[model samples]
Target: MMSKENYEYAKTLYEKWGIDVEEVLGKLRNIPISIHCWQGDDIGGFEVNRQELSGGIDVTGNYPGKATTPEELRSDLEKALSLIPGQHRVNLHAIYAETDGEVVDRDEIEPKHFANWVNWAKEQGLGLDFNPTLFSHEKAEDGLTLSHPNKDIRDFWIRHTIASRKIAEYMGKELGSPTLTNVWIPDGYKDIPSDRLTPRKRLKESLDEVFSVEIDEKYNVDAVESKLFGIGSEAYVVGSHEFYMGYALKNNKLCLLDSGHYHPTEVISNKISSMLLYSDQLALHVSRPVRWDSDHVVILDDELREIGLEIVRNDAIDKVRIGLDFFDASINRVAAWTIGTRNMIKALLYAMLTPNEYLKQLQEEGNFTERLALMEELKTYPFGAIWDHYCDEMGVPVRENWLDEVKEYEETVLSKRK
Candidate 1:
């Protein structure tokens, strides 16, 4: 009763500013964030002959109840999704494929391996996204796969990526929505490389071959993710932002921008508009980086709001694919997913509740003082009430109360896991 009363009062406050609170919530319900499956398992994929987590990727801490199997992972995901409002998609790596204990190598992986996942998504009424895991295998032991000097190594990754696309297509066909198949390779040098051009050349040619076999865009859209540097590739990363940006522009592929992949000073929020101008669509792997690419769980910080503002204000929510890409083993995995995903949704909701057109008009008129003042003042508005109402309306626990549910889950389902 109190929550309902508060929402009514808050709606009146925003109504004075010409912000339709109910309309905003309606739009918010349709925005689907692709929640990452890796968060539940610390990226320890279900490969029969799983190698140690290599590449620049690392998941610190070992909280109890990490999902050890595909069923467990999906169950964890289901719990996380129920707490988060709105429908969402699940992001998967090729490593997560189930092969029935068969030793299916990356290149040999087929759509049948992911049939279970497609079936599961159909039952959940959820969409699926895919990535071809290019690290943590014998082929990528040297921190090189697609850009390896050896043609055979490059060809193997190319075949794996092509197969991944076919699997993504199958997922899209089964689920009735386009599956975003993003390819991110961990190929780079820790020490300064004398010759950077050759590896990049190989990567380009390899990508050319991968995309040469066309699948219907209706079923799947391809994206290439870039990294600035990594644990091994600190000195040189073959798939730098410039490399993939140029490649994506020329080849009609989506350029996936991971928030944690850039220099500490760079923000993915600032790049969304520029990327959209050149390409019809782009994708994002939203992660938090403390100092390096640490992949901490996301929080509703300044940059996050700016990212939401950019997407909402520009009317590019559909054009920019949003997916979470952080995993922390230090805390309960379901709680981590719940926190990060809820924060993302909150950021979007905050953006939508703002009087964006009025602010833009202020900027256009060169009213800097009013613009700054209004922006800062708007921050203190009754945003929490609006958020609480949203959660209630969506059949989710509002605010910090969700934490209690997470604690219950930890005590019951998670604690029982080995």
Candidate 2:
């Protein structure tokens, strides 16, 4: 959290840099924010026992191993919305049920019930973020078998893609807003020296079909490509291979980049530039580091933190929609989310204050050291210290204390996990 005096000092520095704090703040104001929700063992569940939470098993059994009834889930969502400041909206990812090892159809759940939940949220001034996988939760052969050139599997994917688009359209009409559709296909191949060509063609065909239907004059479909390793004996294969973004670009779709999904060694700016070159809408999933796991922890400054924001600023891409795609089954769920959100917001503000012309000049001069110094200076600015600065200046609630509350909550959750 930034002290009021420190914030004033930082504002002075911004003025010194010939940067219009008001103009930069105005641009920052335009970004619309949302979050992803699920009601399952993966993310939308309670963490009572450490073993169950860490072992990927559901012990709390809070929501019957499925999403709670629409009404019940919406209650939790309303609570979440209350915690956020201003007219903050959420993108609810519907939970699908698997009965006797088989996927259940969306029709099994009453449409009226779902619509009622959407209406309730809308009445409370919240938005929806719909996930397509909710409708295509079929349990087919594992990736090892699906990797084979099987027409049945290929057709199944096509049908799933089409069905997902239809569901999004229906939800959009019901919610009376453009539905936020997030597509993360968990299909992949396992073995090495396998025929990647066939799977690639099938995947591309499915994506093309989705693009043809999902996007239009009203709704915007964002394709979130994740980088995952093998699932079992077979290595998972979707868009992990090289040139996957190029394929996505060719299809005329936007790319949602999960920060933790990439290999740690990959250059963030280069990836952002590539996505921009293809005219793809960039969506970010910010998370913390966990060895070989998408642990979705709170952002810490000691780690590779500054570089993440630097890439975003240097790229000068402000239209990017940032989602706090956090998953914390542990006890301090709200605290973890608050801390992560605060850190990310602070980082973004720091990036916004960066001089675009100075960055260009540094690039032209080929002085990497000077460019890094400027970034470091910006990071230390007190106005960039706490996101509450903007809220305070804007006459919103002073929220710097949320960070402290989050830190304490995280400590409690970790102690219980241990």
Candidate 3:
């Protein structure tokens, strides 16, 4: 909640930061933006009316292309990339499709085709981000049987991690950029007590495979996973603490943290500090808080605005790769993408000028009571609102109407329970 005084003070700070609100708005008038468009159901659904913002879509799901032929995937990539303005970058997630509920092996795909895809991306001058999951698949059954005493399954897991690293090497060689790989395990506890110790051991072993595999010189992989707290059989009990991704960081692997995945009570600044202590690059997933649900809403919601700003002011900003991770069902994909991107940009701009040093100084100098007062004052700071206004002025559409839609959605859910 921004107060009048806080808002005015934020305005004064913005002027000090040399941010010409009017000039930035003018530059953004025609800048391109990027989005993720892997779900086929959402492709070509909504047309972009404004041309000022442009970027390439991230392909995540199966598309019409050669599973083994990079040229075929490249062709599909070109088609999707063509839809956006040329200035944007395209991040391709998994390229191989599942067959009869099994992921096709990357080896099945010709190496020449993979090279061709990279060459084509180079020709088009588009940036590339590759997800390691491109080489593997996880079935619901796999999640259930992860702790099973089957040597064959364990071998498969090892193979999956190694193959993913190989693909990263290939992409890094072709794209001339560090290969990006995010590890999100679908494995977790279901109903009944499982051998927690065993799963942790296996996960560590699989990660060990990642560390041993030799990748290209410039390619650096970010090992990312999440924590889920909710009901039902799929509810994950062994969250981030159990896997101990910090061990990877201790051993020099990049750690990417998702904001929504933390325990509800975890402190945001503390989490950011811990991540920075171990890794060089930070990846964050932005979302609004909803009861027991990881709703990927835009960032302006009160809870997200406060915590998100604190994160930016901290030292994490320099190393952060701020990416939008939103989930949508078959409907309203375009609206989801538009709103998600818009909110991310707005939050980032606000973070760029947050009084992080001021907050830190106050905390260092004062007792607990003094620190609390400073925090309370920081929360009401009008920096976010001013940034929002700047984004609006720059023609980056802020969906005030959509905020009402979210409220309506929340109300409907509450009413249904009643």
Candidate that scores best on TM-score: 1
lDDT per residue (tens digit) for residues 131-206 in model 3: 5431123322444222235656656655555666666667766666666666655455556455667666666665
lDDT of each: 0.94, 0.52, 0.48
Which pairs of residues have clashing backbones in candidate 1? Answer: none
TM-score-sorted candidate list, best first:
1, 2, 3
Give candidate 1's TM-score: 0.99
> What TM-score number comes out for model 3?
0.66
Give a tens-digit lDDT track for model 1, residues 38-125: 9999998999999899999999999999999999999999999999999999999999999999999999999999999999998898
Which residue pairs in candidate 3 collide? 32-54, 33-54, 33-55
Report how far residue 4 has shifted in candidate 2, in Å. Answer: 4.5
Poorest 10 consecutive residues by lDDT, candidate 2: 47-56
| RMSD in Å for all candidates | 0.9, 6.0, 10.0
The prediction achieving the highest lDDT against the true structure is: 1
lDDT per residue as tens, model 2, 246-341: 665666555666665666665344566556655646666565535543545556554325534554454544546566665655434444444565
Instruction: Evaluate residue 389 in candidate 3 and report its C-alpha lDDT on the 0 to 100 scale.
Output: 59
Q: What is the TM-score of each candidate against the true structure?
A: 0.99, 0.75, 0.66
Q: What is the Cα-based lDDT of residue 17 in candidate 1?
A: 88
